[model samples]
Target: MSGLIGRLRGRGRPPFAALAAGLGLAALSLSACGGGDAPPANVVATGSAPSYYPADYAQVINASKGEGGTLTIYSNTDQENWAPIFHDFQKKYPWVKKISANNLDSDEVFQRVLSEQATSGSPADLLVSNAAQAWAEFAAKPNALMAYKSPELAKLPKFAQLLPNVYAMSVDPLSAVYNKTLIDQQPDTLQGLADLVAKDQGKYRDKITTRDVKGSFGFTVSHAFTSARPGSWAALQKILPLARPETSSGTQLEKITSGEYVAGFFISAAPAYPVAAKSGGLLKITFLKDGTVVLPRGVGIAAKAPHPATSKLFADFLMSQEGQRAVAEGGLTSYRGDVETRKDRHTYQELVSKVGESNVIFARYAEVPGAEVNAFVSRWNGLLGH
Candidate 1:
């Protein structure tokens, strides 16, 4: 993906830039054809009946009709992973001319949305982020998000909803991804991995991969690990010397697939599942038998959304049963218990049953204070000799 994007930008055909340029050229051509004096085109409005809405959901569906306007979303999730959800949404409401989804880093998305809000602007009708700290920061600001309680929240677990507006779109369980061709055998537990690394430290030097703890998502996962186990930092100290640190999971997966690294730890299952499935036995995921961390990706509406009702409808759709099924089909683990996909994959409920509730460590996103993050980063940098 990075290589493709780099090639596109190198060729002076960046996706967003090309889109804007094409729009400008179309207007210019219209004016050149003696249509400059003509009035603007009229938008055709559709009936308030959305195909996916329930009988009692008519009121909200009616409210979601934005008079043929477009809905824009700012998200950290990859566009491919959420493409099905967007396609279904468009099918339900054909009146919405466009649904612009921008994929950016979690920190970039947070900063851009906040800056726009401060300037009385709205670049996105909805925001989805993996960084919990960003969500907390946005919640601190007055009217940063428009609150709306979804009726579907009742069907979801309590942990899925952070507030009336903010909800978990997906919960990704962290696992160990290994290159089967490089490693003789995969570790069944985190302790087994630590022991293997410690025994053959020189053999695996710089051949293992893990997230850089200083990054937004990295801090969230690493802090949760340390908080869950008393000796996690000690284990990390013995392992970090033999591991390469990366900020992005995609890079880690690619490196592992290419045999640059034997294995990667604390990798999110949402993105890893799709990559591993496509690798034809080269990549494999293992949930640590000792315990594993589950990270929730958040979704919420912008306060000054251009299509506020449309944003709410999209959010509701994500939490619906059909949407949850689509999420699982897209290779993301759904939090809803009822969602089950092919290949005997596990839903949140199935995972709990298999791993045991006591073995699943849910990251306390809201309780992680700023001071703890600072201290963790400082220690991590010192340990890595950065």
Candidate 2:
């Protein structure tokens, strides 16, 4: 839910770089390598389709080939984070000529679709975001999202399906990120961090940062953390006063890396882990011991998609085994059990195993009761002294 995390210049090897090298850009020059089994220029290779695919899946693929082979998406994710998955999608469906993903605020993903659809018709074939409440609101709107049940739907956890059509793009955990040079003692839980700050009040004051709960992502993560453990409020009360509330994950990570801020909590792991992997021992992160909140980024096709057939193909691809692997490679946490765990790259399966199922707090798709949301935000602002 890092709504404002734009192009990142991480020091590590670009995600999926190896895969891209091995695959080469053969799709662009398919005719150069003559293969007897190759599908026609416009159609996908039916023989290569997964066995789990629907019987009529070939029809969907062929239909997409005739429908202009382009897709437009409204999402909160940066293109760099999506490059691996996009690369794989294009490689699989060589006919797809363009993929336009506009990065926006989580809530804006829905707003843009709704606004455009009501007027000149939204160009969005798909929409992706982590704003749970906004997704709930959009679902309430008639014909907002197409009800396309993917073949991979049954393979995913029930919770992965946010609504009839919306699905979790990635299941990411909220974690605490700290600068190794700034703090001698590393705490694994929010309460421990609070205790550490209280021990040296003067040194820690204004040195901790977190998401501002006024925004959707910030509010969702914080609310889930607090709700999962009521006693966490005691810890937050001590921490928030001495902390600065940031509107973006990128800024929090940047300031922490530069030592301007010593630590940050309820930070998104999707972006944090990849950056930490290449921080040269400067940045470190820990899943909260008391309760780790798992936020699932949601994706779905638009009801009035300009490229519905292509959108359907892309949606199915996202939930497939290969797609999930690309998702993890691209730095987003994959939830599929089959996706193997790698250094710095996390999967929801590993998170559940690490934290114990009880401590893995899932941020559900439903809107938090309006009255409850208002109360939570009010108290959160109070603790921040805002």
Candidate 3:
């Protein structure tokens, strides 16, 4: 995995004027408009994303004229830490300008990308994001993304695959999260939490938590449910009344930490617990037995990027030691087996071992629209009733 990113929803649209020179913000704006009834075109469509990088793509892109230029980045990387990565990239491609679509969530990022696609504005050349499903279409589906490969990708693990265009950069485990001290004892897996609720219904009733069936956290939960217990989501319907899923993962985490409820879910496996524990927060989690449930981050270049050369350079930079280290500094985990940072490699290994390598659908959202997630969310909303 190249860029196993974090979660956010409808959050990534910045000011149109500030987006980039020459392009209007019409494409970048997030509108809850009607999506195409049919899922996006597949790879066979006129312009499918690159599943296999051409041998000389890097040579050509790196050798291009606009060697020193700035390219817009639609991402969720925190400013405080990402500065170093940008700075390092600048060192490599001093001529290229690097701008981040900060504070924007995954949905907003996708919306902006789509908007750009429609307006014929050069979509952000580099998309450093975590929403695998959103961009899957561009890589394998028709006319979604252009095909181009970078030599850097070859260094990553085979499991970190998200089509050829996208990279599985980082990793996170969907553990059985809980606020510390809330639950008397920490169970070993998600089933433990359910059992806790079943045995001590009074304690967790209405106070328990999970993500709304909207974001990736809940999405991960759904995948896990489907795999472990085919009909578990339906079973969860019985317990929905007790679950207080919030609109956002950040919110879900905050509620559990404040002791408004005892136990809830959180990403990141055992190694990350210390970070949460540093705050002296009441939180903990465990891995399931059967399959490893992990969340890998991925990203790819826009098929119609304005700065083609810059895009390749940027992606290459990301795959480099400097870029990888920069991302690691953001306190995230990557699927790259040989991440540049020493500490992150250890942290990543710890999480995967505990939670298990998660069930990841590379670039499925943008490609296979209704396969697993759409039906799941629809049923979930019916059960949750908003």
Candidate 4:
């Protein structure tokens, strides 16, 4: 394990402490979308777990167990959120002696993984990131990520499934979180927020908050909205001036609860849900009626992963019913229709039902062209004066 770590920790790599701090900030911001309710204790699997795997699921597991090795993963997911999933995976596959996991910023993960791949060293066996654009851009390189179509993909919503190599593990929808005490009237749609900002410009000035589009995760989301939603750029331009831009959703939520900011837009439901649920109704999350952008946590396997069999097994496990439930329990948005949670929250199906299928924009990074992304980023930088 030390040898593998040393090999990957080559020249030009930032210290783990620095990576953690950066990732901690990004994770705190991204995880701000969490739900308030605790996941049910006895989450019943939709069906037999083995059934979700391919016909040779047992063979894959057996092979992985036979060829024992450490499985290293590079991810941006919070440790608390991923602990349950990792625990379950270990319990299921005891043959794998150790699992080395590192939490880093999405950009750092991309760079480190790319460097490791280039050296033909022990790169990450598995890669998980919220930055969809990074994964999409990586997919363009031949053999950058392994291509495996899990049987569980058939069970996921069409929107959750990305390229054959990349799969959406968690579906975090962007919503509006407001301080109920400060804002008497809640806007049901983005347009409504725009109107409020325009009509009562003085009242809402410096009262709204959102991700900094210039930042990594923020750019991915803002860019997607630009490409997917018509006139969204115009809406953003009208609304951002009223918003106090911040990179961390935790910061946004804190200020909103403190009455420093009346509302926050484009907030992930993952972190916001739990905070609002526990806020004694002081904080509330609302899915925009016009449309809600679902930011999926993209999971993929490195093409040159050392523990290929184990990587495949783990990836397949993540997409299983049990894994999806763990994802929801971990406070992420579950994309599986079979999974259900507390009444206060909207299941994947409920979200689609309430918002209408057309209004739910799944940010498929693979589908977005690079030129469009550059244009959007340039415009966003100009608008934000970054």
Candidate 5:
């Protein structure tokens, strides 16, 4: 997909000569439409600052224009989810020639930044990830991130400000998914699911799925969900015995889709929502009625950012109304309440409305005590009979 987008940027062409004939008409259409050589006339360019913008916001834009180069980012999300954002950002800030957005694991995003900066310095200007533990660990290092407080910060929810530097890029709720055809009694909560399975362990034994809880994402969501309430561990005792643990959300969703697994809990909705959208009634998803864990993907500028001014501009742009709407268009849940609601996209406001404000558990950016984490993982493993 990144390669496809690169081709769209006119940086390169498709490798196969055989494809030229088929692509010729599309090329003609692109040329006819000016091929995005400039932003549309209606676009309020970044130079035209809004009233809410900081007095010095114009200086940042001018500085970025002076930099006049690619704004490199290391992110945990796929390029498909970033394409719309990059397109919209470029439209607003035309001087930014390109955005090199690389998709990597949440932990790897920090790893690359740390390892590179240790040597010749990283080219990455921005970093985005939802792995809470990795984030806490990274921020513990000296000069781990740039401590620029965005003017848009005041507009965001307090929890969005994960640290002095890091902030939430998107708020994604963990969802429970099932093969509706295979399970007639769909459960809305973990406790309910446990009760349903307990009625007939023969049918559900080894059929339920959840995260492995060793990896960063799995641990963050699992720990948040369980620690949110008193009875969660009790519910897990019933469910985990019959569950198979997987490392990736995509795998869990696939198994559920194929009926290899009857249901999966603690699955990231970033991937699940899109799959459920096109499942044609085979898949169904619901937030846990007891407690829904909302994981915030953190975004921060690198301390040694190659394009500091451009990174700052991009960070502020992400918190703007237009940028939030574009984020929703990219299939990410926007947290800002001002954005208009759509049936296809979920938002933090909608999650609160459905699950209630009190039941929404946010995975915090603070580090968990090492002893507590070790004990939790040990108990979790024991539940799996490991």
Candidate 6:
């Protein structure tokens, strides 16, 4: 039971069938690791993963030393946030040097991976992003990623099961963010917020902001609204009159932080934003009636990683309780427990507090999330009037 939840945090379960599916995946990951040879690198798009090779399996375990090469990680969260996570990771494995090669936008990371894999050379050895669903295509290919069960798997709380190879680095929950001084009352539920928006009319018409759905955080809000709406996403169209768009979560965060807007839907990737809010940083947030859409961004290693052993070692550390907690406490969502609200007036309150709780993790559903998200993004791209 203890390993059941955090281990499977991002997994969609409750139905017996879902649990069975999880066991099967775990078994698959285990079987992959048992061999010495790594799986071939073409199974990224198919349902079945490549078989693990004996030599490759041994190599991954030895990679903890960062011997042959380095681990390249990419993510959209600001560098200011990865400090603690990176620091702790380095401290854990001094030999495994992490090359924080590039900080990318959510919209661009996937395309970069595709381009890099197609021409530059190999796909990134490790990827940490809000766009894991985009990876399903790669997963179907043979030996696209190396699967391993790290020792820290026990510290993972519960959500770790859904994504056997991916570790939730931190919590980035999408919530309704408001200016504490400007808003008279915070809406606790969806209908309540809908009424508030409609009543404010002109005041909120262009004042409320969000990232365009073409990106990760933006897609989250779009998905939530669509799910909450009836018959069609058309129900959310009414809000288009009041909605304005940004290319990143940073813009919306700044608007709310500056008092330029009373409320905006925030894709809180950087915990610094929320910490700023709690520390009298002007912004405050709450899950809309449907609850905040939690994205536990994380890393996964490629099976053909030239440095497969090193990649596995790095991946293992990233999932360990220490790695998850360091990032979670730093303000991003934690996969193990609910974020311990700073309940203080301090910037980076979550980080300052050193997270002690585990939060639920969520992911972009592989089958439906990709196509479903594209449809929504295109819809917004063609919003009647931007």
Q: Best TM-score goes to which candidate?
A: 5
Write model 1 residue lDDT over 232-277, tens digit each, in one string.
7777787777887787777788899999999989887776877798
| Deviation in Å, model 4, residue 56 alpha carbon | 3.1
Cα lDDT of model 6 by residue, 242-280, tens digit: 777765555666676787767766445454345455556
**Global lDDT of each candidate:** 0.69, 0.76, 0.52, 0.69, 0.76, 0.51
Q: Residues 1-386, candidate 3, lDDT per residue (tens digit)?
A: 11122222322111221333223222211111112123222111211113355665546555543544556666654453354455555544444443444545654565666766777675476675555555553355455555766566577666555677776545555555666676777766545556667776666677776666566545644555565556455446555657777644445555666888666553434233444556565465455553335555666777777777777666766665446665565555555555543543333555555545453322233332344556766766666523
Higher-lDDT candidate of 4 and 6: 4
Kindly state the number of residue pairs that clash in model 6. 53
RMSD of each: 8.8, 6.8, 10.8, 7.2, 7.7, 13.3
* lDDT by residue (tens digit), candidate 2, 219-283: 78888878778988899889988898887777788889999999998888877886788899899
TM-score for each predicted model, relative to the true structure: 0.82, 0.87, 0.72, 0.82, 0.89, 0.69
Per-residue CA lDDT of model 4 for 1-386, tens digit only, reads 11112212211111223445454332221113232334334333321237445566667666776665568788766665665665555555545556666667665567787787567675578888776656666777788887777777777777666766888888888878988888858988888888777788778888888777656566656666666776876677778777767776777778889999999887777778778888998998888878888888888888888888889877877877767777777777777777776564346776787688888887766534546546665766565422
TM-score-wise, the better of 5 and 6 is 5
lDDT of 1: 0.69
**Against the correct fold, how does model 6 do in TM-score?**
0.69
Q: Which ten residues in a row have the lowest lDDT in candidate 1?
A: 4-13
Off by over 4 Å in 6: 1-63, 66-69, 154-158, 161-164, 228-238, 269-275, 278-281, 337-363, 367-386
Model 5: colliding residue pairs = none
Task: Give the winner by lDDT: 3 or 6.
Answer: 3
Which stretches of model 2 miss by more than 4 angstroms? Answer: 1-48
